[model samples]
Target: MSPSLSIATTVSPASLAGTLVSNSKNVLCSLHWKNNDATKTNRNLKFRVCSVSGGYNTSVENVPFPRDYVELISQAKEAVELAMKDEKQLMEIEFPTSGLASVPGDGEGATEMTGSINMIREFCDRLLAPEKARTTRIFFPEANEVKFAQNTVFGGTYFKLDYLTKPSLFEDFGFFERVKMADRVKPEDELFLVAYPYFNVNEMLVVEELYKEAVVNTERKLIIFNGELDRIRSGYYPKFFYPKLAALTKTLLPKMETVYYIHNFKGQKGGVLFRCYPGPWQVLRRTRNKYICVHQQESMPSLKEVALDILASA
Candidate 1:
C-alpha cells in the first residue's frame, strides 16, 4: 500500500470561533435590531452571530439576545400598556404684529412698563403707580393706548420678543412642575407655545393663503405621518386648530425653537437616545370643533419599553 498521508489540525477557542465565523463555507447565524418597517428606522446596537455561511447551513448552538435586548423588549411593551396620561397644554395666543400692548394677545408679554426701573418704582409709589396694569388694557391696541402704562413698555421691534420662548420648548419633553391643580395631574403635560411674527395670519390675506394652501394642505397631505394625520382628522386640542376657520400659519417664523430629549435605555450601556425631529411649524389642525391627535392606539411595545419590561422581570 502507498504511504498513508494523514494530517490533523487544532484550533484555540478564540481562533476556532474567528475561523468559523469568517469562512463562507461555515454556517452563519446573526440577529440584528430591525425596525418593524423593513427600511430599518432604528437599528439595534449589538448584533449576535453564531456562524458564517453564505446561506443557513451551520448547526447553531444556544445563542441568546443580549440581556439588555431582552429588557428593551419588555420596556417597549410596558410603555404601550402603561397609561400615557400626558396633557397637551396648547397656548392659544392672539396679538397684532406692529400694534398691541393692551389685549394680552395670547398671554405673551401681557405686562407693560412705565419708563425706567426707578420710574416704575416712583410710579408704583403713587396712587396707581404700583407698576401693575392687570385690569387696564393699555397693552392691547398699540397706537391708541397711552404710553405710560406699566405693561405697555416694550422695544419698537417685536423680533426679539418671540426669541425668548425657545427655552420653554425644551421644557415640553421632560419633567415640569405645575401646581398639580384641581384638574388632577397627568403623567405628561405637553407645555409648549406657538408664536406669530405678525398680528394674525388671517389679518394678512397672503399669509392666510400661504398658511392654508402652502402650509396645512401640503404639510397635512404630504408631510403628516400616519399618526399625525389621524389626529388632525379626530380634532384633538393642544393639538387641534379649527382648519375651516380663516387662519394663517405665516411663513415668517421668529427665530426660535422648542425641543425635548429622550434618555435612559436598559440594554444600551450608555443609554438610548430619542428626540423629536423639528417640523415645519409647531401647528396642529382641527375640524368641526374637536381634537385631532387622539393618541394612536399602540400596536406593540417599543424597544425602550421592552427594555424596561426586562428590567422589571429581572
Candidate 2:
C-alpha cells in the first residue's frame, strides 16, 4: 500500500498555496531580520542538513524492508535469504507489475516514487542474478502503476518528522507542539531516516537543532537516512546547513550513529532514486467505470451501556 502526507486545512487549495508561498517568504525574511520577533518566528530549516553517502549499500541490506522503507527492506532481505537455495523461487517474479502507469504530471511525490521504483527494478537486475528480481503491475490507486521487486532486499529508510510541536508546550516550542513518541522509540523499533524536500536547506542553526534531537534523546539506535544527499545531490547537502542537522541530531538523541547512507547509481549493486505515483487515480477509484460503488448509509453512533467485563490478569 502506498501512503503519503496530507497537507490540508480550512483554506481552499489555491489560497493555501498562496499562503504557504507567502509564509515561506516570510519565513525566509525572518532569517535575516535582526528584529527579535522576525528572527525568532522564522521557520527556516536550512542549517539542519548535512552530507553523507547516498543510496543502498551493504549496511542497509535487510529483509522485507521495514514497514515503509525500513520495514520493507527487512522483509526483502528475509525474502532473499529464504529464496537463496531455491532458484525457481527467485525466478517467480512478475516483471510487468513495476511497469504500471503512474499518476500524471509534475507532482513531486509521483515522480519521486517512480524514480525510486525504477532504481529498485534496476537494483534487482544487478543483485539477484535474474532469478530473484521480477516486476509486475497490480491494480491499486484506481489502476495505476506499481513496481513490485521480488527477492530484492529492502534495507533503506525514510523518516517522518513531527514538524510542528504540540500546542501549549514550551514558550518557544508551541507551533504544532507536542512530541509524543521520541521517548518511547527503542532500538528495535524500526526507523526510516529520509531527508525530505520539505525543509529549507540553507539555514545552519535550525539544522543543528534537529541533529541534536536525534542524537541525544534516547538510547535506541536510529538511522537519519539522507534522502537529501541521495535524491537531490551534494551541491547543497551541507553548507553550514546540512552538517548542523546531522550534528545536532547526534547531540540531542542518545546512543545513535549518524552515518550517511549513500546511493550507488552505477556499479552492479549501485543505487538509484525512484519515484512512484500514488496518483489521483486513487481518488478516482470511487467512480469505477460502469460500476458505481454506493457507499452504504452512514451509521450514527450509539452510546449504549454495555456490560463491563474485565478479564482477570493471567
**Pick by TM-score: which candidate is best?**
2
Model 1 / residue 306 / CA error / Å: 14
Residues 1-314, model 1: lDDT tens digits: 22222222232222122112223332222223222222212223221223323433332222112123232223222222221222111111121111111122223432221112222222112212223222111111122222333234433312111111112234456322221121321223111111221222121232223233323322111010001111222233232454432222222221111111122232332222221212111111112222121111112224344344422332
The segments of candidate 2 whose C-alpha lies over 4 angstroms from its true place after superposition are 1-72, 75-110, 113-161, 164-199, 202-211, 214-217, 230-314
Q: In model 1, where is the ten-residue run with the lowest total lDDT?
A: 219-228
lDDT of 2 at 192: 21
Worst 10 residues of 2 by lDDT: 277-286
Query: What tens digits encode model 2's per-residue C-alpha lDDT throughout 255-285?
Result: 2221212121222222111211110000001
C-alpha lDDT score of every prediction, in listed order: 0.22, 0.24
Count of clashes, each model: 50, 96
TM-score of each: 0.17, 0.24
The positional error of residue 283 in candidate 1, measured at the CA in angstroms, is: 20
